[model samples]
Target: MLALPAAPAAAGDIRATVRDRDGKPVADAVVVAVPSGGATGAGIPPGLAEEDQRNKEFVPYVLPVQAGTRVHFPNNDNIRHHVYSFSPAKTFELPLYSGTPTSPVLFEKPGVVILGCNIHDWMVGYIYVSESPHFAKTGADGKATLGGLPGGDYTLRVWHPRLEGSEQATARPLAVPATGAVDAATTIGLTPDFRARRAPTPGRGGY
Candidate 1:
């Protein structure tokens, strides 16, 4: 009989906090830590085949998964929905459907994926599949810590939906020791009017 192997221990940790010019915490900011050497395939992530459905909207609004992971979209609403995205990470669509699709949508690369429903124009969602395992999304207080990072050189980057400039512009190199804390920070100017509005009622006449 064969025995399963033990899981690898976390080598290090990355404790990060993001704040604006006024020193106030910014919530829902995504922080990604990409390995400099471009060596992926470390360990298996916790979740896969995540569900993004039309409950009159995208469930998570923002999803972060490992590269090569599959995502599922099930139409939970009564009406059918056509989901598609123009993001470079992955570009595909599911024609109007009521139940779960037979095959899962796979994200082959590492980048942010923006989703929208063709039938319902107001539906919007994001999928961020990272190449590196060391990454985390900031909480309401703008604090995120990525533990279990192997000690090495890495390029850490920050991304937001409301960001105006390039994602590469906000990137900075990070060096994590075998066992210690490192502080990384950044401030980005966001678009002035950026907010999500409720979708219009289907078949509602124009004013």
Candidate 2:
């Protein structure tokens, strides 16, 4: 009987650069890597992620979490907020409230979840339910690093709130080295951001 070679261990890291059509760095863009053979969503232990409501806005604006993660919508503002989402990924509502709900919402599917406040039409937020545990959000420098990834074949995808077209259209095949690091970059065309701008309010805090 013939025995197959042992599978290579996961090593190295992936640094991804994301830019807009005109070559400007894009912040808050979600980058995900789905292994070809199949990825166990990041081995992320069951936990809670918070999407706080402050100053009539959803803090963090964009959040990326592994599927099966639960999210808390805590209202820190003086005013009550009614948060809801029509996104196919997770559809639910939080009636007008002033504080955190007793329970968190579980997002079990892999897709984009758009959040909005019924009281404030201008208030909008996004929760990206990642199918793979290997995901990162680009920072102000337009770079996101996925470290300690096992070297293998992967489908890399980039998604932005204002991404012009379908998120799937931005996917590309990637081959990670068994050691060291790999650099990858992608340019995404984005439509104009139509989110409403509100005056800065005091007591604003991070998510």
Candidate 3:
């Protein structure tokens, strides 16, 4: 019998804790790993198609995809969803969809792309496509561990739907030692509201 090869050890890990100005752990925070060279050798796991429907909502409120990944939209509700965004990451829309679309949505860049259902007005979702495979989403405990990072310099950034500015403006630098652990902590300010709601009743339309 042939012996199996050993799995390669991860070069390093980035353990992090996120908190707000008040020191309370922030939930739904997105942490991104970007190498300085603007290149990556990691392949993303297969992604499933998602839907944002006329029930005035997105099926999955938060999505994490690797850069250059494709996402699909299948309208599953009786109503329609007009998904669009002004975010620099990727700006697109599926005016109103039903069943599987002809093509999936592609995210070429690494950043947070905020989604909105123009028709519903109050529906929103966030798509966070990471540049590095060594990333994880924070759980309710507000902790995330990014393992298998190449031992080198990385520009790490945290993002949230309500984040105040550009992710690049808030990124921090860290060096992942070849064989040790590093704890990184950062605080971010958030906007007052992060909830979805129904649009106000339209006023009497002109005859």
Candidate 4:
């Protein structure tokens, strides 16, 4: 997808951390920053927005994309997969296939889209569609730094797949500096994963 070419004035960065209620780092959590005034997608470039099926699961597990970007779903495994998402933000299905699809799916709205494979119940991934281009997903250490944001007032929030409450409840105001980096953080409450409790074993998985 294409991005606007406008550049931000006095660009800065947002260094953030995601922690659980017990003060433990949280992974796969998406952090979003909505500008108080200005186009969120302007002056930002789109990154690799692909979700690949490999080793019977979705790689990366979590993807953060700016609104209006088209995302690719590629099957890198020997077997085919029917990837689909019935989410309200963007709902569509891809027929069973391998390699890459002929075209990518456009995510026009801002919201969380849960992806699944019709042939594999254990295959679950998430696409965090953000209205603003200023976003990033927490890594193993639950740390993510979003750079190139201009100095301004913004509403910051974090989203997790198993978050106990809504993303809106985690919202807070933030002031980004004109240069260098600033710190922001959030503590979340999570719910149990809905997947089966057993560990991966041989032969019972999708072929």
1 or 4, which is superior by lDDT? 4
lDDT of 4 by residue, 1-207 (tens): 899898756888999999999999999999998888646745565545788889888887998898888888989998888999999999999988888998999888989999988778788989999888889899989999988887888999999999999999999999989898899979999998897442454674555
- How many steric overlaps does candidate 3 have? 0
Alpha-carbon TM-score of each model against the true structure: 0.83, 0.88, 0.78, 0.88
Query: Residue 141 deviation, candidate 3, in Å?
Result: 2.2
Clashes (backbone N, CA, C under 3 Å), per candidate, total 0, 2, 0, 0
- lDDT score of residue 23 within candidate 4: 95
Off by over 4 Å in 4: 1-9, 37-41, 45-48, 197-206
After aligning candidate 1 to the native by TM-score, how far in Å is the CA of 148 from where it should be? 0.4
What is the C-alpha local distance difference test score of each model?
0.77, 0.88, 0.74, 0.87
Which ten-residue region of model 4 has the weakest summed lDDT?
196-205
Candidate 3 lDDT tens digits, 19-131: 88888887778777777786664545646546445355776777777777888876666654567888899989777655667888988797788888666667788888787
List, residue by residue over 54-107, the lDDT tens digit for candidate 2. Answer: 878899899999888999999998878889998999999999888899999999
Question: Poorest 10 consecutive residues of model 1 by lDDT?
Answer: 198-207
TM-score of 1: 0.83
lDDT value for candidate 1? Answer: 0.77
Q: Model 3 segments beyond 4 Å from truth?
A: 1-7, 41-55, 194-196, 199-207
Name the candidate that leads on TM-score: 4
